[model samples]
Target: MESGERTLITLFEEIVNRFPHRVAITAGDQELRYRELDRRANAVARRLRESGTTDEAPVALFLPRGAELAVGLLGVLKAGAAYVPLDPDHPGDRITWTLKDTGASHVVTVPGYADLFAGSGVLPVLVGMDAEAEAPSLRGGPPGAEDLAYVIHTSGSTGLPKGVEIEHRHVVRLFDVTHPWFGFDEHDVWALFHSIAFDFSVWEFWGALLFGGRLVIMPKPVARSPRALHELLRVQGVTVLNQTASAFARLAAADDGAERPLTALRVVVFGGERLDVGRLRGWIARHGDAHPRLVNMYGITEATVHASHRPITAADLDAPGVSPIGFPLPDLVFHVLDEDGRPVAEGVAGELYLSGAGVARGYLGRTELTKERFVELADPTGGACRAYRTGDRVLALPDGDHVYLGRTDDQVKIRGYRVEPGEVEAVLLRAPEVSAAVVLAHSYGEDDVRLIAHVVSDEDPSVLAPRLGQLAAGLLPEHMRPSAYLVRTGLPLTPNGKVDKARMPAPTAETISAPVAEPDGTSAELTDTERRIALIWQAVLEVPRVGRDTDFFDLGGTSLSLLRMFQQVNSEFGTGLDITVLIEAASVAELAQRVEAARAVSPSAP
Candidate 1:
């Protein structure tokens, strides 16, 4: 298929015509063949056209991750409208903000979420309501190659999120340029493991459907549990897998005792965060570099999804510390420029600027921001071309690879999610008690990072901590929420009166209150299982002592730490428990009850 010849919908139509009877998507027990998917999407497009959707206005997809999501995406494109992805897991206010900001005409969602847009003034089209409707006669028309395909909202330095308007040609160019090098075919089974709101989903979803490959819609719980993910990879015969560096580390660590773990996986693409090549040593030792080639792609939302790719090998792991982000894609050009916007010499660290077909149009409704970040550069060939200024500090190696230094701004990536500290700080300041606020990311482990909030308030630390946490929970997503909340009388300041982040003290266990004594004034005795769990929590959380009633998260345990805790429990007890169990039982005492119940039902119970 030619890159500029058609939009994604037309390209997908061509594939559907060729492979109608083939299974296109699978989620749990539901499977949709290519023909059926096309017909269903056409029906949805008919309904959307009736609702007055157009190429200029985008439709909001507020559905869960399932076959319906795939249908919604294709259906919106078939209707000649860009689709705005909305994650149901985001806070209600965030969703409402996005819905209003985008000014979408309609939202495609199940009945359960219809109430979320109740007062938002947008129409909701339930998935099953018009299942028997006729397919749209105008399918795959109106939208041109340069038309907007989707508007993905990303974190902003300002309090609100900014929508990135990406065109069909950019997406087409992405697959067009990378497909030949990656060699993705119909035989490959791709996993849609990321939230649709995240840019990574763009590559995962389209890379499969556009290539005539079977796409597996991973359930949310399965995506979170490494063991479950490992089993799914084997059972579903997933050939091409994509994961963030942190998530891949968990998956690799979960394969401790398996002889041939992830052997079915042929290609594993790592993106959304820095690829710490050292973390892959265990997986490489077990499976070797021959199968499931590891490719690290450094990218940003503004630049479509990916900009460069580097195939990591065991030899690359032996390097001291630096992991180089490989060369840019054929259609894209990257330049390392100094503060003056002049290109820097090779090996000099500077801000990276990207110019290419994959570069997005600009931030929606943010004209000044778009102008500042996306600027026109004088091309050596004579005409001026636009480039996106990536606030990343990178040094271009002599061999053409780029070594990632760090960020030039306050943006920090937590678990592969881009977080602007100012955004979190803005949310923190919304609380009435907060006089001043600062949010920062701190290293929880070698490969794990967590956010922490430092606030200045007259209120007592014990009194204000929980309120701030509650506010954050109601406002921010899980990744953006601060793992630890520290209250200070006043924030440390530099000589220039700016908040001195370097002088901020790290949060300690002392911030957490000790577990209360038992009802009868005596300490609660721990059972054998409880004792084991306590020990594991202590080791994972780095706490000196853990009481039976101690909350894991309250003791500074995060999602990564919870995974390690579960791994330890599974190893010690020989019991397979899902990570959600920890979420359900936030305290050791409650978790002990769950463990006892599972043990009683176990076939090997003594």
Candidate 2:
């Protein structure tokens, strides 16, 4: 085989041959050298084959991040079967979904996690990697480059997760593309910070297994704290580090610097979330010259792991704004397309679409969805060619770099106007003392769409309100500016670590500090009825801001919340308005008017 044209299995073989004595993985106090990992994987694979499993069979691995997870995955590959990684910490429903989705008949897990799928009808025959399992005879098996290696399920924020089936060729292509960035060698010790279930872990494993680099898996507790993580890196003599943006942000936010000396570190990579430019600069400054090379990688689960990475420099730190995600890595092709599927002009915002070797073979078991998103492109060659329609909105810069905008679905139509939540968030984050910002839309029955901004800051919203209005005027259209601004101490986060915008509080009039009246009286003012209704809205939505024009749903008030509001209004006013009336006139002002009308027409009253 040519030097660069090696599949994942072949790559692992090379590592066992050339660097057998080098340490490959570390879990707790246990260590597995490259030779040990290879030998054990071969033994496990031989056992699996003896059990009647073949190269195409699905083997499920429900282990946490550790040596066993690594060996188990490679063993499945060696047995000519695809491995499905299931995070033990994930909810049981999610795990069950994966099991049924993949039809996995065998599972490799420790004794403690064996019963997690007790009732699962397909009940994977549990295989133990402990000392008790027989160490079977090792045998070599050849798998073609196009054979499936693994299936990675995406974080199901929108719906049930779909598995992206990645082949060995995709893995080989990625290693070839990113090898030079980290300068992987037998001597390098790469810390595994991501969950084995995450696609990034696939990169970490392959980077080490192929290049002969040592993989050091940190304990679960240490992975949670920056100080503990820092100490582990230094103590373990880790040379390469990789973490998601949120993890890096916590590390950068910590006061302790020397806790993890960066002297031995050669490279630091961040992915899985949007990187905050200011936070990145702060991290670079704290580590100083001893800091390793910083890389911002961009990818989706549909793309094996990472499709592109750009090395950060001091000049990049000094420049304005967050850095562009940079160009695609070698063998990958990035295209920016307009709504009509035509190529977008330079510097124009468009939907980002990915093509080339990094793209996966489509969602496993979801033919309709797979065909919808992954379409055959116009490739001159007669062979198979595909492109993924990433719904991400981005602007293609003149330098061939791309600037990320918010998701296309997040765009809202407010007051007969179009609005992008990211534009609002950008303005809020740029505000003084604001550390983070999230914008969520609330909707009521009417055409009203209200924008609520959740900002993390100690600054008083009263003082921040007018200034924000001023800042927003220049940057946003009237409709896009949030009707209500809320200063939250912090935002919520989902399990996968991305910001939980869906859980953000609705914006109400209460959160905003009343602006001082201008002498010219140009500011919008509320009438007594408006004020009373706003108060009612604040009580109902549990938000501080409630403009008369704001939609009840737009205030984060759901139908359930509206129902409660109706009960409260009925109790306070002694009005006998039916629940149907409240549901019909969903807007606060409209519902208030209905209350007044009902009072005026009540029979046998007065």
Candidate 3:
């Protein structure tokens, strides 16, 4: 491709022509060669074009993660339209909101997911249903560099999701700057572990396809299980892996005592949330800095995907507080500024602002918000450009690296998903039983945070907690769901009468309402395996006692806790089990049953 031709499709096409026979994508047992992928994507593009998708128009991709998703994304771009990724696992309300916000006329999905957009007035074009179809037109070119590449919706404070419009050039610039740093090539295998709805997927998806690398599409189940993901990395010889710090923590913990879990990995890029350097000590000790480079990147969806990169070292882990975000991508301008927008002195904490080629166009349909957050500033060359005001508070080190302090706003990232606490609180207050609600990000483990909802309700705590959980499950996505519901007669207030979040009680095993069977009632006795599991839970959760009927989550167990428990179970029982097994089983008795079943089949079982 020519230097000036930097659109995603053009760059992708160059790679496709260069490596036609190369394996482009691997999902489960299926593999698609570059040539076949191009042909399939072209066919999808033609179908999208025929369905009235025009230049820069949003086309919703509601398909599950697989070869079809990869093809469908490329096809949308090829059809001269920006793709809006809708997570198939997202709540229907969220999907509906995203579809309506993007005004997408066409949706690309697989079978069984057609119902996701049934009444949304979107024309569903199912891929993989007929794979042998030919393209109606292959000569049509992709959209211009300035045209929209993708519109990613992020949590909004206004109780609705806001779409961040990123242009093709912005995406191209991101790769152009980071390509040398990552050293991606056709020999490398990248894992698409994140949901397509997230901006991180942009890096994982195009980073592989544009560089002629093999893209391994992680199934939802495999993505959730750290053990399974570790096995997949080794099995598939994955070289480049990107994960949110929360997710990486689980993976790193799962690798404890295992023979070098990620032997094939060359670079592990962390984003989405702040990297807890201390939590990754186990990983760094297992594999030193020379083999697999561990990088902590801080970014926002508004700035394409990533803005800055920091190569973490074992020594740097001891640096106090959160890991430094390091330096900005080449040509990107970052400033730590005070409330007055003036640059703060070195070592002073201030809001982070970024301006560069990677800066996104603006929010879709929200012009005022776009102007408020994305402001025009003069460049060093006396040229005017836009810069995004990242709500993150960072302290600039003398060495040029910035230490991520925390968010200046209420926005918190839970498992890499940008969540507005108010958005979740709004949903909570809608419930008839909830008189008032306050949602906050509570840290369960190191750098691991979950949404905790404190609700004031007239109903009993036991009755209201489960009802609220059910309400959240229906209205919000899994990440947004409250890990623990603390029902209070009234919200704790400070002297000023404002809800004092600091004064709020931390969720504990006793405070969190669980399905605890009556002690005098018909509670099943714990089996040996169940007894061991209960002991593990009791220690992990710090609860006085864990009964067979007690739910792990209700006992303040976060995803991180589950990973820890899973690691313990694997070590104790010598049985290979995925973390999803815990999530699926949920309760103590159910998980014990699964453990017993696995142990029963194991030849090593006593």
Compare the candidates by TM-score and give the number of the best one.
1
**Which window of ten consecutive residues has the lowest lDDT sum in model 2?**
514-523
Selected candidate, larger TM-score, 1 vs 2: 1
Give the range of the ten consecutive residues with the poorest summed lDDT in model 1: 512-521
Report the lDDT tens digits of candidate 2 across residue range 1-606: 974456788878887899878888888788888777877787668777777777767788987677788777877888888899887755455577788899888887766777766766543444445554336434346777888889877633233566889988988888777777666888888887777777888877777778888888877666754556767788888888887655565444442334335578888787765554545666667665336778878777787777677777766666545646888888877777889887788778898888888888888888988898887665546564588887777777887777666466775544222355775787666776788877777754322346766678888767765566556544443445565566668778999999987776554454454431122223446656557766877766655545555445434454346557778787766678766555445455667687677668874332
Alpha carbon lDDT at 71, candidate 1:
83
Model 3, 1-606: lDDT tens digits are 565567988888889899999999999988999988988888888888777777888999988777899888888898899999988777777788888898989999887887766666899987752556455444346678898989999988988889999998898888888888887888999999999988999999988998899999998767765667778889999999999876776577557634556778899999998876877777777788867998988999999889999998888878646668899999689877899888787778999889988888999999999999999776668887689999999988888888888889899887788999989998988888888999887776665566678888889876776677667777787777776677888887899999988888667767766432322224578888888888888778755456687556545566577878889988888888776666556677888888888888896864
Cα lDDT tens digits, model 1, 294-319, are 88899999999999988889998887
Which residue runs of candidate 3 sit more than 4 Å off their true CA positions?
Answer: 1-4, 129-131, 136-141, 378-384, 513-539, 542-590, 597-606
- How many clashes (backbone atoms < 3 Å, residues ≥3 apart in a chain or on different chains) does model 1 have? 0
Per-model TM values vs. the true structure: 0.90, 0.67, 0.89
Error of 3 at 121 (Å): 1.4
Worst 10 residues of 3 by lDDT: 514-523
